[model samples]
Target: MDKSTEEKIYEAARKVFILKGMEGARMQEIADEAGMNKALLHYYFRNKENLFKAVFKDIFTKFFAKLKDTLLSSATTREKLTVFIDNYIDLITANPYVPSFIINEINRDPKVLSSLMFENFMEPAKVLKLFFNEVESANKSVVDPRHILTSLMGMLVFPFVARPILQMVLFQDDKVAYNNFLEERKEVVKNMMFKLIEI
Candidate 1:
């Protein structure tokens, strides 16, 4: 099957970035990997940083609307949590690069994620407030909103972030088995977090 120009560029960019790291990667290399010229790559993405952000945002924009809606809705913490875990894990499994892309950007520049989340993704305050509001609501299992927020996020994202090590150590580098573990994690995480928060 043929790939679109943007898809080709994204795939090429991801490969180059992985091999050389973002700072060391060059657009010419990505263009070469994509079987295109530098000018054509520039036509789609003006610069390396732009290309990088475009790649990540392409995935984020697809899911941000649903995430925003669930976070902002007046649903109980349990209800919102179920939706969040389901959608989030679905996203991670579908795009395994999503978590690493985010973590790499954060590592590249600490403030980058803050900028991405606050300015690009959604206002940080509203997300933070979602947790606090949950505590105030009749379902009061979420007293430590900040802790819950960080813990839930860590729980959801850690396995993917640590996939290489976990896959090697826990599953003897069995890719399919490791993936099954992650898939099973959806229900496991939900049940464990619910138990923790008593929500």
Candidate 2:
């Protein structure tokens, strides 16, 4: 029961923090959202900052776990990229607010951003660099793997991140259309990547 209540507070705190932001949210609001009293909220988290940190770290860890496995596994470079894109898209699509939540919080605290950047979050970039090094060492005729990675990131991440505007300009508020766009992208991204590498 204690653990369950704590989880409820955390969930409510996360929702309030992401929606209203750390500066704008209040303990009472979180308490109300959690269906608990403000005293109960303080009992679990000392303050909004502490609660925000817990929520931010939890979300960041989940995001990086997917990246870490895809990058560190024994998959081929192309295979890794494909898996990464699909996994990444799946995550963001399910949690549409996640990108905004992350970007907003990072803008507020760059130090936190730097810490995450240097941490396990960078596994994908490191993997791409290693792949580039391997192909170059073998004297294989290929464009830079970094370029391929960048292109894939652009193709996959940009659409999801820019969804608000794209919804207006391109997708036209049709959720089905946006979904189809993403579905097509799974193959479109792979083909574009293969073309970029000429492999």
Candidate 3:
């Protein structure tokens, strides 16, 4: 198939997957969204699972590529944590549906997370080691770096994952209000991290 046609199908599939999720999304719907026939979509992807896997991998890459770069960089731990928080807030805010979609699919099929993890080759342990080294160099009070990392991740991601309820309860179902709240969280999360690390 031509590159343009493939891109059209990819984008369409991404939309359908994000909106309807893996089990709910239909091949015909994706074809309609792509302005192509179902046969053409199948020609490129072979099946819905294949198409979903491609879309899932693409979303996962977009979400984590910046994180990997920031964590692996030579910046100080404080600086790395700050940058990571900022990047994470920006990424999740821009693609709010991504977290929920991935979480929901992982819940439906436990293997989804494992497959994505293997495909991404993300060694979170190394990132945690960087955190541990930072704390040791600073001679801070001893603590499990895993807890710190999990706390940081949970703080950053929870709002996006719980957006629907938050929007209703906190923002009166106003999208603009909810978005402003997220924008505020960028600084809030950074400050919280700084406080946690005593930077």
Candidate 4:
């Protein structure tokens, strides 16, 4: 129950939950990962559900914090687009399991998804609304910001989420090629968004 011990437990739990997902992760795995005893792990979290929820909440918090800073700041539209694409790509690439983890958990208990939306936790939709408003005012262009945002995120995220299939079909299991493609996406996504939105 010291701070360092508590931090260790949380960090271990996060890795386990993200890797195995909520239903698949076992408390023993988390305990082993933390180099702690089951009793002590229970002392901190009391149950697997509680521990998973804590880790999931932390993940959501970190995600929202990054997104809010990117979307809400007073950067120019181009700057914001670059920031959004860069931050989103970096986050998904680094935490390759996160998008699927969230989707799986929410699928199991849809109420959790609703709760996140109701609580306005890093509300991507709200951010899109603001960006759309700006785009309309700036150019009166016909582009839908929501569509653009979805396309950008899908382009950035789909490959990582479907890496196994893409590897077999597209890259012939060439990780080097996949990585190079992802790196190129950093610029490709930015250019695609700018072209779609710029006046």
Candidate 5:
């Protein structure tokens, strides 16, 4: 019932889930990692799914909150894009397991994406408007902004999602090399987006 105890459980669960993923993680392992009994772990979280949901939602909420703040700032749309891509790559690099875990869970159960209690805090429509304004300012034909958004997301996230194969095939399983690749990708994605939108 103590807040510190709950925090300990949460942190333990987060590490276990990150390392083992949803299906592979066990409540007993989390309990052991937290230095708590299984009963206490269940008392705090009810089940593995509930604990995973809490962790997943917290990570996504924090990420979207940062994204929302950046998008709403007074910077130019191009500047926002650079900032967004840089921050996103940094987050994914730091939490390497999160993107793949989220994508896998969503693929296994589509409802998981919708079940998160967070509101549409990212305000995607407003972000899309920024894209549209940028395109218009560039005197480009009004294309669907969703395509641009998806491209940006895919470019930034795909490497993290496909990290294993990328590391094996591209970096000879050299982790340091792959990490450097990710760092380089931040600038590459920004340049690619600028070229695509002629910004």
Candidate 6:
């Protein structure tokens, strides 16, 4: 029961923090969002900063865990990459501000991110091995895993972070259309990536 209640508070706090950021989020707003009392929220988290840290760490931890699982799975490279992109897009859509939120947090305090996450959240060796194996099997020496990873991040994240500009300039502020565009990007990104790595 306590664990479940904590999750509820985390979910509510995540939404509030992502929506309004750390400085703007209020305890009552989080309580209201969680359908709990302000005192109960404090009982669980003590204050907004603590709650923010917990939520920030919790969400990213789970997010990267999913990605790592996909990497470590027995699935084919294409399958792994597809699932990886799908999960990443899903998280970005749900928590749109995460990329920017992370950037701002890191800029604010460089040590904050390292302290928040587990030591082994991402293992560079496993990740590089997976991508390199794919490249070697395809016999494509020219295809760079580094490029794919960097490009994938930009393609997936740029749309969400630049939402206001893109939605206004190209989308004309059409919410549904812009969202549909993002949803469609899952496959579009997959196909584009497939072209690079798939034999």
Off by over 4 Å in 1: 1-21, 43-46, 53-65, 72-74, 114-118, 121-124, 135-142
lDDT of each residue in 1-199, candidate 4, tens digit only: 4658778899999998888988889888888999988788889888888787778877977876787778887577777778877888888888888887877888888766565565555476677678878766554456676676677778877888788898779899999998888878899988876677765
**Which candidate, 1 or 4, has the higher lDDT?**
4
Is 4 or 6 the stronger prediction by TM-score? 4
Candidate 6 positional error at 179, Å: 2.3
Residue-level lDDT tens digits of model 5 in 69-165: 6677746877888888888888887788888877777787777668664365336556657756765576364556667778889998899889899
* Local distance difference test scores for all models: 0.75, 0.75, 0.82, 0.79, 0.80, 0.78
Give the Cα error of residue 172 in candidate 3, in Å: 2.4
Global local distance difference test of model 3 = 0.82
Ten-residue stretch with the least lDDT total in model 2: 134-143
Candidate number of the best lDDT: 3
1-199 in candidate 1: lDDT tens per residue?
Answer: 4999988989898777755656878888999999988888888877778887666555555545666666666467777788778888887777676667657766877764554575655564677586667644633564566776787889989999899999999999999999899989889988977877776
Ranking by TM-score: 3, 4, 5, 2, 6, 1
Give per-residue CA lDDT, model 6, range 71-146, as digits (tens).
Answer: 6674677777778789889988876888777666668777667885456444744675766677557636565666
Query: Order of all candidates by lDDT, from best down to worst?
Result: 3, 5, 4, 6, 1, 2
What TM-score does candidate 3 get on C-alpha atoms?
0.88
> How many residue-pair clashes does candidate 4 contain?
0
Q: In candidate 6, which residue ranges exceed 4 Å CA deviation? A: 1-7, 117-125, 136-144
127 Cα displacement, candidate 1 (Å):
4.6
TM-score of each: 0.76, 0.81, 0.88, 0.88, 0.88, 0.79
lDDT score of residue 147 within candidate 2:
64
Q: Whole-model lDDT, candidate 1?
A: 0.75
